[model samples]
Target: MAADTAEENGDAASCSTATLSKDLADLPQDVFLLIITYLSARDSVACRSISRAWHAAFTSEDASLLLLRWHFSRSRETRALVSGWDSRSPGTGRESIAAVFAKVARRYHHLRQAKPRLIEKIDVVQEATHRDLHRGVAPWDRILRWNDNKAIFQYSDPTWCMDDGLLIYPGLDGGQYVAYDLETQRRFHVPFDNADKTVRRVRLACGVLVIEWCERAPYHQLNEREVVHRTFATAYDVQRAQSRSSSSRSAKLAIVRSPSDDSSAWTIVFRSEWKIHFLGLPLNATDRFFSTHNGTHYALYIWQPHRSPWGDDDPIEQLAVWNISFPSAYRPSLDPAGTKRPDADLGPSVIQRLTWRELEIIGLRQRHTPAIRELAMDENNLYVHEEEHRWLAGTQSSIFPPRHHTVRCTGFPLVGIGPIWYDECCADGDVHMSFCPRSGSTAGLSFADADAEAEAEAAGNRAPTPLPLTSYRKSTWPGYAPCWRHEEFPYLTVSDMKDALAGVRVVARQCFMVEALSVFVMPRISIEADEDADADTENPEARFADEMWTELMGKGRIYGDERWVVGEDAEGRITIVRF
Candidate 1:
């Protein structure tokens, strides 16, 4: 009798299996892809083990592309690289799609979890050359001040910029520049005649390097009444320069120049004198001076402090925008003196100016003076982020006062055709704001207390636990409505870290933070924080696990892109973290 009952149970199990198979086979392609889109990448990949029909659907190109687009819609770089793979090649079977999907999924999973597959460091200043440059010069003579009996080196804030996967910075000798391609692991050195000047800031984009430098006025022209220094911006074309293999051991010892000795390697496409004065005061004394560029458009933003000459008048601050067009051909005749010609029609043009009064008239009413926190630019629009601080009456205060923070984004079109728009969003004082240039989006953290009644109704009398929330807003065009979303992020928050936050990016609905020494990636959506879960534990086929690099601890001045995080260590080394 027991054997008969066991036989009946076995038959029932077979019937259930047959039913699932038939149902999966009957599912339409569009419906199947739609269902897969809702599942996580790991779960979708694991669905192939269910049955032949399930495996076929999950392995199809249509399914893979759908999942990639849905999960990584905000990541244009990832989508561009993954979508170019052809799964219909000769030896590649239908399973190729699944394999590619799994690989891409794992890559981003590592990124989101702050686990890098590889960590590489490159010394910006060669040890031998560093010693040679400081051989005879005293620490005080080289702009180094002694604070607390320790030599404090004074230099620009961000001495480097990363674009198109290349880390470009001024060479220590000031006669050359270094370009290290993070992807190719190759280095290129472009020489320029910056012998007598000090490089204040460096920017690179679209194979062109824009350098801002200041030099002492010629002795013959120097006087008490005249300006003591001159500043200029010069653009160099370094696209065709020869690159050297950086994989060799000797490459790490010194900056090596390429074999090409082309005298015209420093093609000056744009050169203009930059006036450092604003409102009868030197701009270096102002609140902020920011400059950025896309391949086609260049933008310079200056935000001055609020001051009132008349005590009874309201304080006035100014923001000026300069739009410079990059011409493909270099024109020597237009700029014969190597200075900006005011009479010339083709040069940097002041397109827009916004003052405190004008901003107030445009509905950005502020109770306290606003400070410019960040400035970003793209091909079409220039974004200015302003924050106002107001102390709260009753709140727990830490190192910083508990205050309400408000963000206002004023976007201006580069082409000067569309109406200028302004959007305002507010966040709790504790939230750290981050901006993404690629998507024109801003994200921050928002915290709320748990609703006891709702938690009891859902969890059946279990105690409620607070959840951390992420608030995101995308900048919209003139005629479109703004996009905003609030999602639960159970992984980490701004208050949890002790290091200074450098940057933040939101991809695939996951928050990634670039901190001084580490990259913090938010985990997948879950109600509970699973400390034991690996980065790719959900995917059984994952090739790598979560990795931590303690060597990256002292690296500050952090920056990141879609796949790499670049930081500058205390000893002036460039650390690249690849996921």
Candidate 2:
């Protein structure tokens, strides 16, 4: 009898708990919304899809949800919307209210006025402006096609036309590097030889021209070791060198240019060798140099070997940032004993490495490896095209399988590794560019409401009009202060042909192939950050992920236009694609 009474009490307690859970699940709509409003936009959308009741309960009737509804209505494709949304963190719950309103307003403005159009489709024709090369025929075609057969003027590499109106070419033999100035009508030849090692590739950014020389070690028939590739780099100040002479392209030893001063002539910024074992495939590394408000940064994207748990060498790709203004202490000669220098001044230069493990919540266990195509940085942003590959099949074997690549444009905060925004497109590459209007190109503040205020002021109705409380107006409101010194003109206008000329547009010509790429800044973009932006001393990859929200005030905000010009071989045509 005592045992039966105890069992009855236990069953009664279990029944009560079950009844309480059901009652809570059946809570009234008003009370449930109070709890749901705190959830993230993504989670809120997910919760609303759980059941018919949930779908009915969650509506855009809530004023705070108005912006979210606008975004969804514009982009019904959930995947695209989510992909763009993931680029930045929408603060939890009510904190995102103001941000959402700002986004909606921006979207309205973009749709209303910034309707991009293709103004002109001019063909890139190479006319025979110079008579020496060919008396009658257009020599551009023949000269560009010159190869080993035409030994006197052999040139196989495609000409790289930079935005600064300069052309760079890698000669066929004997460390012969050529630079031609279109403005001065001068040509320069520099014999950049390194113990007979060939320059495999080159990249130019800011005023620094980085030359990559690579040589393979001799092979031994009986050896089972992997192939060893030795690589080295030498940076030159090309801008100063260009301004040095207007007559002839003379062969010079070194141009002493400083990163702090563009007026300084080309300088040898020291040389460093790269030692790494390569797999059977050829080693492919791409690098870029860009100047931010704080300092010049170089990003080297290379495939490196990572040891797996099973002691096997797995390829790990990395994008490393270095300060080009300072010499690297990590060079082999700096520390011959291979000891770590804890007190070394890595400085604001080549100092940080942003890894996927540090950026993603999944950490290093991610299955796909991202193939970085290129690195682009502006005064307030760093952008990269990250291509993630996935195997077609799941197998336990050691052999590699066929894979597919998905390209994504990832934007990082100006100061850290945390992503500020992300966008997915069905394109092969991604790049970012910004432009400030030429003086008096458009009406004052053509892209802002301040233009109306200026007109009101001119009419003598200066009632000290109050600024809009929206984030867009507050960012540039008169007397409004920022944590950093903002640019005098930070936005772009593309409504008219003049605005198009003031900015840039990119179009795709299905025929041409892209041979060379570059970006240029008129006058020059400032590399000085604000006092507050300079206060964060943490490594880019070590900062708290939450800093992404605080650092990225406006997501999907870009200035000017990014255009790519691709050169074609047969027709000598070029295609420009704008981003």
Candidate 3:
């Protein structure tokens, strides 16, 4: 009789709890959203385990919604969960916020361990003619393809993109882009968005390029076969008496292109290599260069290097920013300052801008103590993103540690042990260098300051601080900032070409970023507190794990040993569970 009474009490308690939770569930969505909004990531994840009915209530929403809320709430685990959902949703992006939340909330620790750095980028096209008033050229040229391959003899650098496990070399002319696989020797030309212009000079950073192009025929389009849509800036320029040629071909272009079209008159603009230390993919890159005309919207999209192109990088939603078009009369092909124009030269300088996304992604590796496995940047400092290794001076023999060191000219910093920053801080050496905690920190230097430091390499002097490097703008989350942005005059979109810009339009500057990563964790994970599991500094891993549990209901597996660990779900959710 006593046992029966106890069982009845427990059952009654459960029923009452379930009934109350059910009532809470029935409240207006805004009310529920509001009620739950105040909860911490830990509390929110715990809510799902509140009761079976509550689980049914919250778990019903797409995980992304909750994850999004988590991000807004500044939950690192929640951000990771939301990020894991990246490229997962096809069109609508997500269905059930609860489902998305559940998927990542569980791995909140992993996300914190494998936190992604927000890379900033800038793209500008410089232009010159009987036109505007600016000594320093901005990438802003209204570039299009011409008819004959011989017509435009100029080119730009290759901006790197990923597709089908092949590296996309987006140059001024798609004809020159080379695709190859380490496993397979397969190679192919990356189709141009516009077929009319020929490539000239090109520069690279983080496996990308800062390219310059010369116009060919009226309607030159590279990546015509690509699914993206674009818009231009100017219909016609009034350079006193410049004539408006047949440019109807420039408007209403198609997406796809034929292979044999023989991209007309393309050449590389210039190339460059990365200069700043980095990890991950890259933050932003000078990998690609540009310019534009009046009233145009130019945009540069950065692609993440993933195991599977279809799975890792999203086709859309990766674009950095929009800008103006390339100007009418500047060309990298032409020699500086009235040099005699060559038959091979494209024309006078038109537009000049560099997207710095490569540095952002590549920042992942250099955040921690590194072992130089392999890494590479582009030439000309335009753009660069690559992974390689080199020898380093060590106490023992030349030892290749596990971590890697990196630098990108685009501008960003990270530290880590693994493939991303936040892994380890290596010691200083002739070739190998690491960050040493200092008493004071400074800011305010330009990319040019880095250039000057390089020029003074013989002197071995400390370079000035750079504001842009420190200017990274974090998401709503803290410690995440300084995303570079460079916009052009006129903003263009695919829809605009279909509806507006029928005859007149403008172009402006654009921004992009490079995303670098390290195999290292930005912050320690799963460190638990003995006194209060809610707060502990010694055990980052425990804290990470607990935080993840709170976001994900305290479930999931751990990786590595006590010394090191990593967690990324099959869904690409990163979890860190260290004891």
Largest TM-score belongs to which candidate? 1
TM-score-better candidate, 1 vs 2: 1
Q: What would the per-residue lDDT of candidate 3 be over residues 1-579, giving only the tens digit for each residue?
A: 999999999999999998776777677676676676445455566777878867766665433354344332223223323233222111221124454454344444343344322211112222122111111212111121223211111112213322222233332232345443211223444333334433333322222233333334222222333221111211221111121222233211111111122221122222111101111111112122232111232223233223233554422112222221232343322322326433322322212222334333554222122212212211111122222112223222123432322212222211111232232222222212223221001111112233454455336432112123222221111111111110110110100000010011111111111111212111111211223434423213212222332221111222222112332322323332221
Please, what is the whole-model Cα lDDT of each candidate in the order they appear? 0.44, 0.33, 0.27
lDDT of 2: 0.33
Give lDDT for model 3.
0.27
Residue-level lDDT tens digits of model 2 in 1-579? 889999999999999988777642266755664565344344455554677756545533342343243322222111222223221111111223333433333332222222222211223222223111111101111111112221111112222323233345443343255654432335555435544444444555555566554444432222243343344455555543332221211211011111222222233333222222222213222121112211355555454444355646545544455555554435432333447433344422345665545545412222233333335665555666433322211122113422322335566554555645665422121123212122222222123444675577478652223223341332222121111111111111101111121122211111112111112111100111123344222211111123221121111111122222223333322222121
* Residue 451 miss distance in model 2 (angstroms): 7.4
lDDT agreement of model 1 with the native: 0.44
Better of 1 and 2 by lDDT: 1
Candidate 2 regions exceeding 4 Å error are: 1-163, 173-175, 218-225, 241-295, 304-314, 327-350, 354-356, 359-371, 379-381, 387-407, 413-420, 424-501, 504-506, 511-579
Residue 171 of model 1: what lDDT? 65
After superposing candidate 1 on the true structure, give the runs of residues whose Cα lies further than 4 Å from its correct spot.
1-78, 81-106, 125-156, 172-175, 190-192, 205-209, 216-227, 236-288, 302-320, 326-343, 351-370, 378-381, 390-403, 412-420, 429-557
Off by over 4 Å in 3: 1-52, 59-94, 103-109, 113-189, 192-579
Global fold similarity of model 2 (TM-score): 0.38
